[model samples]
Target: MKEERELQDVLVQLSSLAPGPADAPKPAGQALAVIKRQVKQEKRAGCQPWQRFWQNPNRRWATAVLSLLILFTVAFSFPAVRAAASDFLGLFRVQKFAAISVSSEQLALLERVAEEGVSPGELTIVNAPGALIPVNSLAAAARETGLEQVLSPAALGEPDEIDVVEGGDGRLIIDAAGARRIIELAGADPTLFPEKLDGKRVEVVIFSGVQQSWDDGTVLLQTTMPLVEYPGNLDPVPLGEAMLQMLGMNRNEAARLARTIDWTSTLLLPIPRNVATFNEITINGSSGLALASLDGQYGAVMWQQNDVLYLLTGSGDTVELQRIANSVR
Candidate 1:
């Protein structure tokens, strides 16, 4: 009886998937073809399993298996349909847990700097754990796309050594040993860093300051460009509707939810409140953000120029930071 009830419930869900009568848009060519095929297959009668499993008269078990198989096939094949499903089901979502697009430890550093707020002349060890990547040499890294070759602050004169690193589509990471080596060479203590950076592969350029102590004297610059163009209203609405139709979703509901999403013009970056002062400033005649540590002794100034984001961070005066930022050509 329990099993029968479960099977009935599934049937009910499946039945409810059909789109209702409405002014809903029609599916695209490919999607319409698939949907029509699915309907035709459902109407056919035979237990040819591979050829037409849904037509099997075997009842509950075969029906359930075939239905699941169809759902998986459609979901995997169509992205619009997948998006509609995710939106309707609310199964997965992206969440923001911290700021700076770096590690939790790097978030802590930003927050601490924000709290200190401008203690001039105090050379503090402003750590950017995840943001830093080690490279064999900048010359080697210059060969890759989406990376900068020339970047250095005139305020710091000459760096002891420079490093370059890249990240892939997913957040790239380095082991603790590599992180330690990076920090150590950059004149920072390896012990002060976390085990991993789990950060995206934006281009990072590190300029080690003339400090024997790793606690102070480091300048880091990071740049990132969008990997993929913003997905505008290009998703075929009918395809989404068709997908929902497969799941027994009503046409009206599917049509309304399957429409393409228009993301906002500006991407939001959530920086921790305690990290520094958030001030909007003009960079090369464009809007930008300048973050100065609580002590005002260290800071990061950032701006998006030509779709590429530029971040200059160090324990230096804001004037110098801006100058370095302006110098990035």
Candidate 2:
């Protein structure tokens, strides 16, 4: 029964990652019922013990790898935001990483908002970053990205495939009214939004990057310095706080965490606490954030060096992950 419940939970987590239309009926529960019925049938048919199959470390590791791969692939595809005005005060860069504990329920709520919520309004996509281009070798990828140095994992040898994403520029116009509506939908106070932030125009500049993948499912991404610009007089703290609240944090907790963030120089990575364990670590003399599934089967490490951002994810414990990270040159 315990093993069956665990399998059901894993299925639920996988289902949640896949976003469907807001009005689409949820089939996860129904699917779980069907899976349960099948399990019972197998038992009556005198099939192999389910517990033994569930307890296989290799199988667990594969599951973890698949989950993390999907999670990070979606995340890294998000285009970096920027502002075009000469007077924009803030220049945001990926200087360091901070991992915050986020529950799976909170993640589900955020996904729901994304699927059903209103847009920021008056948004425009200018020079959208081009799709990933397949490359024949690491040297070709580096050439396409214009990176002086392209790092690879010495521990894992050569990658089976390589791809590059060309950088470009764009703009975003935020409608205060629409933004406030999203806050209210999250059960947060709309008044927390800054009045000056209304109708603000944010410029986006995308950076060229390369992705390398190994046959065993390990992935490495490296990108040049990406930046974001904001008006000098604007205070982003309040907006950050409100966003934290929308992510299911209490007002006070959200405020505290928001204030601690560098807003301009740091990249925040929210790790679902129920699914993974996260901590700070050093990779090849650079500070990095490391995350591993609670089962210790899969993990990832992200860090920045010489203005280049690097992310590595694969199946292994944190120690093995760090070893691979350190092997990158």
Candidate 3:
């Protein structure tokens, strides 16, 4: 009876395991692929949508692979765009750093000079930094068209009776004209003017920024940048007698005397062919061409020769020397 029971159970299980009815179509061979994919996805922590795949047999995982490949291609090909973005960021950062570095050094120099007392006849920039400023920087080509040369005070229409004082150490009188004009001895010698000068604005009448007509204009062409304290250095450095001399550069002493205002030139004077001399050496650097001098001590005028001045340093002092040279017609 027990054997008969066992056989009956086996037959029932076999019947249950039989394929479904033929009318209900079974899944195709691709169904096997879905089964494999589900197992793979499950291992990769993805949803195993086995039921959804059955509902839609056409849905293939190849589509997902294709989409991923397309994204990778786009990212790999755009090198220039990435490079340009990198360059933009780098340039901005470098520029900012460079500016800070340059300014820091500049400020330090100004501070040091400020703490130290300024001496006479010694040139230094108060607000402007000598370190930041180049000697040649004094002049730049005037962007305005037609600015040609330095015009002398005489060229202007009227002559204001300026404070013309005779220098104590020399024979010539320093002729100072313009706003609040006053000419006094600059140094202890009583031959120069003012103890400390702060000439911020002085309108110029003469223009000679160039050595020749071709040499465009430059600031400090003839006028020298003055020392912070006037007549500070007793041992003045002698500036060469070039075009600057005509503008009244008295070497080292009283460089402020060569003071020039904001002047522009529309005309040009020809370089002279003759020269005047003192001793055996030519006096000023202009060589007498468009340059001449008066031996203020002796009251004699020197002429230009070979583009140089003659009778270099005469008996008169710098103030007198400048006064006489400038007084030339």
Q: What residue pairs are clashing in model 2?
A: 82-203, 82-204, 83-203, 89-232
Per-model CA lDDT versus the true structure: 0.39, 0.66, 0.23
User: Which has the higher TM-score value, candidate number 2 or candidate number 3?
Assistant: 2
Q: Is candidate 1 or candidate 3 better by TM-score?
A: 1
Candidates by TM-score, descending order: 2, 1, 3
Error of 1 at 102 (Å): 18
TM-score of each: 0.36, 0.70, 0.14
**What would the per-residue lDDT of candidate 2 be over residues 1-329, giving only the tens digit for each residue?**
99999999999989977856985765889989998998787777776432332344543443343333222222122311111111121246767777667788876766666555465545465665545678898888888889997899999999887878667665556666666766776667777766566777766566788878787767787887565655568776776677667657899998898898886666655567788888899988888888887876677777889998787877777788799999998
The reply for model 3, stretches above 4 Å from the true place, is 1-118, 121-124, 127-208, 211-329
Where model 1 places Cα greater than 4 Å from the true spot, the runs are: 1-137, 145-149, 171-216, 228-264
In the range 71-159, model 3's lDDT, one tens digit per residue, is 11111111222111111111110100000011233224323432333221112212211111112211232211122322222212222
Which ranges in model 2 have alpha carbons more than 4 Å from their true place? 1-91, 127-130
